[model samples]
Target: MAQLGFEVRDLEIFASRTVADGTAAEIVHREHQTSVEVRDRDGLSFFVNTAEPLESDPAADGRLSVNMLWLTPDVPAAITDLSNIGARLLKTADNGHIADFAAKNSGKIMAHFAKTAAHGPLGFGYHGKVEELLERLLAAGIDAHLIDESYGRTLHITNPDFADQPSNPTGPTIWVNEEDQPDQYGYTAPSGTAPQAARLDRDSN
Candidate 1:
């Protein structure tokens, strides 16, 4: 973890996916499970989890799935690390904001990395118009939703492969946000001082 410049913030465990999402918190109080929260040098923490039987497929190979998006300061260095471990490069953003890779011969993206930015850890996105993408998805008979956010316009679509259960109507979804989105981090007050500038400075300390 230290070699990768990652910091472990906290660890948590949940009985099921719904419990982890706060949906089944009242019905299911406890169960055998565990999870760890890890963050890169940029302070974006993502969870590595182990939930009960219902949350995930026990026999499925999870390596073929892309679950989290990690941010790194050095995109080339991060790509080198993945290549060193036999991971195959799938695609890279022309603007150097994102990189997708597959871990094995499965030909499926297992991990994704985005450039460090001020939009928080959820800043993973691509270069395109959100409205255009939404229209394309809807025209293709896919269920998609759009949100106009201050940071940028975002679109989320349900995973076509996800098996929706009664307990969880919305099984799994993907986020499609405009790349290089604007955020409060780039703001400067009229007095010539930025509010979030101080926060960023303190966070670095």
Candidate 2:
């Protein structure tokens, strides 16, 4: 495995209006002066800066829950490392895309590890690898979190609030999910699928 260095700085919250609705609200938490370095892999590194945040106010008529702007100052070392390991980094627009891609891939890796772990010896090996990879991701500045559930198998890389929407055009809004799974939502399976969840305009509902 290889190590990636991230210099994180200047974290601040900003306000913006939704494109769809003309309401105003705080949006992204900007991170400034961030840089990532990779060693012993492909000698590639990445530099990032958190740009201005985009809001999700309904009054602004915007569909975007949260919008983060990031740039790759240099080619990512992960790309080379993955290539050496017979994997490749998918093309994406920014770091957020890379983070999402990594999180999803990590989920699949964990699932396989879980299956092997059930066997005993191989399970330990799987767990070790999984832990190592997760640690690497975290050290590389990925925001990974476990979603509580019966299986406890969900891993997310971004904050949930980034997906929230205002309830009404001018009302306070919150993030909601319509996923047909049990985790944060206090619901049971076999009863019904997950209901359509949305950030209701605080005053509308």
Regions of candidate 2 where Cα sits further than 4 Å from its true position: 1-40, 57-205
User: Each candidate: what lDDT?
Assistant: 0.41, 0.26
lDDT of 2 by residue, 1-205 (tens): 1122111122121111111122222223336433222222222332223334556466641211221111222224333332222222222223221311121112100111121111111010121223343465589886654444453333344433344743222122221211223343232222233322222112122
For each candidate in turn, the TM-score is 0.32, 0.17
Best by lDDT: 1
Q: How many backbone clashes does candidate 2 have?
A: 18
TM-score, model 1 to reference: 0.32
Q: What is the C-alpha RMSD of each candidate to the true structure, in Å?
A: 16.0, 21.9
The deviation in Å at residue 183 for candidate 2 is 19
